[model samples]
Target: MNNEKYTLITGASSGLGKEFAVQCAKMGRNIILIALPGGCTPSLAENLANTYNVDVRIFEFDLTDSQELKKQITLILERFEIDFLINNAGVGGTSLITETSMEKIDQIMQLNVRSTVLITHMLIPHLLQHERSYIMNISSMAAFSPIAYKTVYPASKAFISSFSLGLREELSGTGVSVSVVYPGPIMTNSNTAQRIISQGIKGKMGLLSTAEIASTAIIGTITKYPTIIPGFINKLNHFLMSILPMELKLKMISRAVKKELI
Candidate 1:
């Protein structure tokens, strides 16, 4: 059996995903980067290879398509022995459910939930081939409570958090660890940074840089942490929500989101 190991990252083209790739490369790990077509992944892959001097392979396709995603996975497993699977690709929006189109809802569910599950399910066998393996799923703080303008997105992330924890228990003593990362807000780009700034205190409360979150998540996963929540404020927020009644938690989040929306 081939002993070569790799870290496979979804949505590796930009944002937190890109930072995760960079951090992994710095650790001298081989990478299999996947992103939607027509992005900067080609150039990013080239740079990582040149700078890190590690094997970096790039695959560009819409992960929302299950059939195409499966095909890509088959192709990936044929070439590399994956040791880490990072399900970081996701989409989100803020809008009233009544105003949100069905198409938009479907897209969020497909990418954030369906594709995550499909890829993880398909990669479990390959991940087990390695002596030690890790799976890191990117959830959000939104998963802890439901907000007014965001519904489906949070629900989808809730699924990720639950799924990762359950899978971790199931994979215990099997040399494979599953970790879920619940980041509050990531300054992924200039636009996101500006938006967060505009939101004032609420946005800055648990906000974290992409690099910080990525590095922490990678290290936590390697150490076999079941749930990784970056930033002290985020951890505190999670603790508070965990103890609150569902109705009160929802009310608090809704008020906070209302402030931002207005």
Candidate 2:
């Protein structure tokens, strides 16, 4: 709220987004936490502000709402300096293309792709003003290969990967470091955990804690790594996937994910 610089993280009420907020606050950085309204952000703000003794401000808004999203960002820019941005608000699902609802499809696109791009596009100017700044867009291991059941989600993540990397090059040597993190499966909740567990060892191959993902991603972003795969298995998987033929890679990944529908 003061003249302080903060890290703005979307979807900060829970899951990986919350973990990023926690780690950033722990690093003694002020924070601007954003999530949909009618959430626990107020309480999370209180906890972080108390525990870390830093300025933790919370803005509750649906990123899908364009007008309000812009309004909130304007207010934030007017009030505080933000040197770091975390585009963590995204959703993914596994199902048949026909089974996916129009609303769900729109939400995924808006949150994962549009909102991320909008947030970054807006904050880049503010970030560049600082002597050093950072941007971290959360992609996924799924981004490396297109899976059958997760058609839209992976494509969206792939966009994030490409966008972040391209923007990193465009901003080369500007001291405004941009990075994309490809995190493996994160057991954010019981349902997600059950789904991953049901798939056995194959599902858990690159699984990492939300804390690990958040911490490692922050470290990589600060160190200016343009592409960060959080776990060793994910890195290896990325490499292995690179060697496979496109058709075979698509078929193999599709076959494995098709099991989720059963």
TM-score, one value per model: 0.95, 0.97
C-alpha positional error of residue 209 in candidate 2 after TM-score superposition, expressed in Å: 0.8
Q: Whose TM-score is greatest here? A: 2
Over 4 Å off, model 1? 1-3
Counting clashing residue pairs in each candidate, in order, gives 0, 0
Candidate 1 lDDT over residue span 136-181, tens digit each:
9999998988778888989999999999999999999898999999
Give the Å shift of residue 83 in candidate 1: 0.8
Q: For model 2, what is the alpha-carbon lDDT of residue 149? A: 85
For candidate 2, the per-residue lDDT at 91 reads: 93
What is the total number of backbone clashes in candidate 1? 0
lDDT of 2 by residue, 1-262 (tens): 3338899999999999999999998989999999998988899999999998899988988999878888999899999898999999899878899989999999999989998988888888988899999999999988988888899999999999999999999999897999999999889878778778777788899999898889899999999898899889988988999999989999988877777777
